[model samples]
Target: MLYRPKFDDLYRTYTRAFHLEVQDSYGVASENEQLQRFLGGEPTTYPEDWQQWDAFVKEVTDAGASIQRLRVVTEPHSDYTRFLLHHTDRNVAAGEYVRYLPRQNVSSDAYTVDDWWLFDDAVLAFSIFTPDGEWAGGAITEDPVLVGRCVEVRDQLWPLGIEFETYLRGQG
Candidate 1:
């Protein structure tokens, strides 16, 4: 069986990590409550898990490494996507570079790729989601061809993504 390292392990080991998120809504159990709160017009406080992730990002970036994420979202964002947009400033404050691109802007071929995280431009970790958008698990590979393609996609999309604040302002 191929070994799948935990996300924390991958983040700690790689100096440069880039994430591409394509889902409009994710069914992460941990975030369901918060999403509901947002949808109901209640204030959604940052949960402990989010705080922990922010701290981790701060630590990694402080050590001279980098963590960047590009979210490809549909226009007229889904409820979950709006929830994410509302909270992304916390991620930015903690040293993660977050950007967004409208789904229409992506090429057909690029849009077919699943969400993934590339580490040090060497390893590729695919985020596997069920048809309903629930987190299933992930697969990690070091195959050069796969990694190269992910790298290429990252390079292609990164330039097109608008910075988080800019994108958020346009939404308002």
Candidate 2:
């Protein structure tokens, strides 16, 4: 969640990618809603200007990257829906190109937002997994099984949005 950019010494080198898995529980929901309320609808403006989601959307859109969203819920929806709807609006408001796919499935396990720290890329990616066990602490790679499991979960959801070039075309 932290980084140092580079060159102009602006510390914008936050080439971090984030991946997290979600589970059918209230833990993540409560925390996420709390965060939204705490930030007072400025979810994309926290931390700093570089942390601004507009910057992220611009970077990816200008470079022509794909944004795929996978839904793990069925008939009923969850709080995560807010993320999709709001961010989609965010992209359009900024005139950024973004393609999103919504899918339904059944996945096991939950994770903390901290799980997204594994991400680091120019085309920055986020693989979110709802973590178990009381939302673990800071980024800790000491546990590979948990890390590997998160990656495995993401692979299953990747195909839902494979046509990057084609997906970008639909974006304005």
Instruction: Give the number of the best model, judged by lDDT.
Output: 1
Measured by TM-score, the strongest candidate is 1
Q: Write the per-residue lDDT of candidate 2 for residues 76-153, one digit (tens) a residue.
A: 434444444333455454433333333333333432332243432222223223354333223334256665655655
Which lDDT values do the candidates have, in the order given? 0.86, 0.39
What value of lDDT does candidate 1 attain over all alpha carbons? 0.86
Q: What digit string (tens of lDDT, one per residue) describes model 1 on residues 1-172?
A: 1233366678878899999998887777788899899999999998677898899889889988899999999988899899999999999999999999998987758744588889999988888776766656668899999999889889998999999999988987
- Displacement of residue 171 (Cα, Å) in model 1 is 1.0
Q: What's the lDDT of the predicted structure labeled candidate 2?
A: 0.39
TM-score per candidate, chains pooled? 0.90, 0.40
lDDT score, residue 19, model 2? 35
